[model samples]
Target chain A: MTIHYPKGMHHTSQVTNMMRTGKTTKKALTFSRRGMGLEEEINVANDFYLANRLAVIHKKPTPITIVNVDYPARSAAKITEAYFKQASTTDYNGVYQGHYIDFDAKETKNKTSFPLKNFHQHQIDHLANVLSQGGLGFVIIKFTSLNENYVYPASHLIYEWQLHKGKQSISYETIVTHSYRIPESLTPSLDYLVALDEWLAHINK
Target chain B: MTIHYPKGMHHTSQVTNMMRTGKTTKKALTFSRRGMGLEEEINVANDFYLANRLAVIHKKPTPITIVNVDYPARSAAKITEAYFKQASTTDYNGVYQGHYIDFDAKETKNKTSFPLKNFHQHQIDHLANVLSQGGLGFVIIKFTSLNENYVYPASHLIYEWQLHKGKQSISYETIVTHSYRIPESLTPSLDYLVALDEWLAHINK
Candidate 1:
């Protein structure tokens, strides 16, 4: 996991080289960027978007069930016994431009393909349910090794999951062809909304 | 409180009287209904709505911040230290008939007015933000003494909250005049969606 942290010296050197050459390739640009976790990036982006009043989105807090709580004088109540609970819906959802938006973000170390096992049956079902209600539903997949992220439509994922028997993964090629790449950017950091807009336009067509 | 629970024998006797007379008033109906908490009632209604494919509403789990966890061998992770966190948004939100729905539910024993103190500033801000983004935002108020529930639009609540300086509450009279009543029902228990539908129709007019 430490290895995944941005190599500070190596990254700085690459930026210096790129500056001196006055030209940089996409790979060089990607390598120069820090390897922030997908969830954190999205959260930062959400905060930025919210501050700008561009969209009202939130990552639902992780669900937990509590068995006991202790109260002390003049202090906040402390949970004593609790366990994580499986979420029934996606991790993220809110309203954007009058459209209901819902999605989950996942980061995978696999470079060749994204395993379907990363998604739970209930989440897939939840996405399908939201879609039927005319809401936009999707998943953000970050290929950690490749340092790339894509916004994959829940409809497409559900189709593949249901249509195939024992086929356990979606290949990188298929993902690249079908999904919109979320570009790395400043301010909002990871501008997934741009990818979302592109996907929305494509689907509307 | 135990006093809040529906009186079993007293309630049964009332029902028996109503049955003997073949006349059940609205008050009788309200009294006969179990005194389930507002949150629990909404959860039950949401479950019914989900199962029937009528709506995709859900009660967002109570937010908590965990500080420590213990992993016992061959056992699920146990949360050892945690504390509740104030939620930034409403308790319930989802999609219904292509409309984004967002709201919080509160129950009060006050027969005259619903106290504004029931809401937090952030929750109010969140509702305003979502409403601006074209989502339907509202608060559901259950008058425990009256056994009546009303869906009060966030627009009205926001207006009152902003306009009235030092005013502490919204009178029940104003609520009844301006909001839709959520009726007690069979399949979905407390059918707030029907009130929502009515509210939507009224607003569209």
Candidate 2:
């Protein structure tokens, strides 16, 4: 007696076998080379920091309101219906060496400017509130097209946000002038802490 | 022609009318006097604090994974299927007065002890991690039956948790001895910050 598997299934099994044997196959190589999104890279950096006990930052979960649920036999309860709720704060916040850190990670494809529309008024207000409480608040802007990232302080963003009544965006040149560039690395992919240290030094000086 | 309303609907409308007219109907008055659940009360207190710019604490949204969704015409997309994801940290965290505050608000009807079962190992580990990073980590425990609330610092809780290999709960006496009593108030109802200030003062002393 014999069993047959589909071609795709056989291919996947071969890849799994290669991974188990520590052999880098074409699929494995492609997976390794695949570029993560800005959020994914930041999450990976957070995990690295957590494992090394350097920081304790986390992305806040998306807000949602469950309307209906179902309990299946011998399984986890499933949400049958839900609605997204408006978020009241920025994306990431936590403590780093006794300092309160809060920031949002944003990416843009446009290389010329980063539109202010990427942020909401409520988010700006929340960041201001965080700043007033003496916490560090900033935004990590990734210009994907240019393969560049910058840590723009919340204060600078707020200033531009308030002044941009007629303007719709912050020019890339202005961002380059005012923000600290976040150097990319292999282990902690987006080392925003370096930028944070520079910003702290500048403010203190 | 008169629009007919159901009996319950009419009763509710009358109660609402009484509330609007500043006339306290029996039902309306009872509703006003009824105590809110611990979570609801905390939420109300958070709103009050935010409005008054006293604090910036917020409850992290429950994480969920969307498996299916439906986009209806001219309306928001509805999550048709989803599942709750395990949270990696506590419920509430934010900056207050240059301090990073992280905590979970819990309630137990048991008048004698707080069952350690209310906490999970992951939450404890997360709290420890936060503490290592110099963040203030604690739990706001409400003895609902006793109408009492206490802020139990993470260090004390972790000490007991590590010592209690087979113990199922922490005695009320233990909590009373180690925790700071959070006096209830009208505006910022929970007023956990008052307890926090006391804890900080004691530690500094």
Candidate 3:
């Protein structure tokens, strides 16, 4: 039976989509190679950085409110009921070179523009708060169809979100102009820290 | 039937203990007031700081490995099966005054010493990593029986944990000497940031 799970909750949906297409051609192979979710790519990069002692970043677990549990005699405790809770902060945060880094990762299939709806009000508020406290706050946006990624400063995002400009979203051209491009690579799939360093250097200058 | 839930899993157990004792005297009232769990007290303090824009600290939600979810028609998705997962890092962390702050809260009933068993190996390693990254790392320890709270540096905790000294825990006297005392108050309850400032000054000096 098919189930309609909330966004970010059902990872299996991506797998299902792949299975339905069932294309084994070269283009399909390339599609599968680049089809990894943004979250997974970030996790892999984090693991690499952690192992090398470069930084200690982590993705906060999805929040859930547990209501009931069952414990058997010789097994692990099992949660019988729970519900997801809306997150008040961004998904990723940690310390990097004495700097507090906070950001949320998002991906869009849109070819022309990135929708502002991808960001929640609380997340925007959280990034603003982190920035006010002198921490570095940003968002990692991936244009899936175009296979492009950008590390956009949270300050610009907040401005764009609140500006009520005729456009409800940020055009690709604006993103390319305002954000630092994250060159994709093999070792750290996302290689976002490079973009982060650039952003940091730009702000310090 | 009584269930032996793991530590930090059953908050209701504290309430159960209170109900079982059935104490309503003046002394019991005092006990209840001071009996608020260390986690809850820290949460209250964090809320006060956030409201006043003093800090952006947050307690991460407990991690759970969800296995099954069910979505009923016109209703929110329900987590049908899940299991608690061991945390990979500290519980509370955020930007404080441009300093990346990371810490875990723990309480002990023993009056003489804080047991090393109260800390997990991963937590110690995580603290060490954060400290190495130039972030502020510490543990908020509460001696429940004594109604005393301390903001103890993670450096000291790591030292004692790895020293293999004759004792299995840090003596109360040692903690008093190396830690900053957090005085309880009405609004914030646990004013740990004051202790943190003191720690920072001492380290800088």
Q: lDDT winner among the candidates?
A: 3
Model 2 alpha-carbon drift over 4 Å, by segment: A1-34, B1-35
- The best candidate by TM-score is 1
Over A85-107, each residue of candidate 2 has an lDDT whose tens digit, in order, gives: 88889999999878899999999
Q: After best superposition, candidate 2 residue A104: deviation in angstroms?
A: 1.0
lDDT of 3 by residue, A1-205 (tens): 1222223222323345346436554355455447579999999889877876668899998998899999988999999999999999999999988899999999999999999988888898899889888899999999988888899999889999888442389989988899988754445667687777677778789
Better of 2 and 3 by TM-score: 3
Best by DockQ: 1
| Error of model 1, residue B137, in angstroms | 0.5
Clashing pairs in 2: none
Q: Summarize candidate 2's per-residue lDDT along B41-142 as a digit string, tens digits.
A: 778767866776767899999999999999999999899999999998999999877789999989999999999888889899999999988899999999
Chain B, model 3, TM-score against the native? 0.82
Worst 10 residues of 2 chain B by lDDT: B1-10
Proportion of native contacts in model 1? 0.78
lDDT of 1 by residue, B1-205 (tens): 0211122211222235345534455455555466668888888889877887778999888999999999999999999999999998999999987789999999999999988888888988999999878899999999988888889999989987887642699898998988888765544457787788677777789
Which stretches of candidate 1 lie above 4 Å from their native place?
Answer: A1-35, A165-167, B1-32
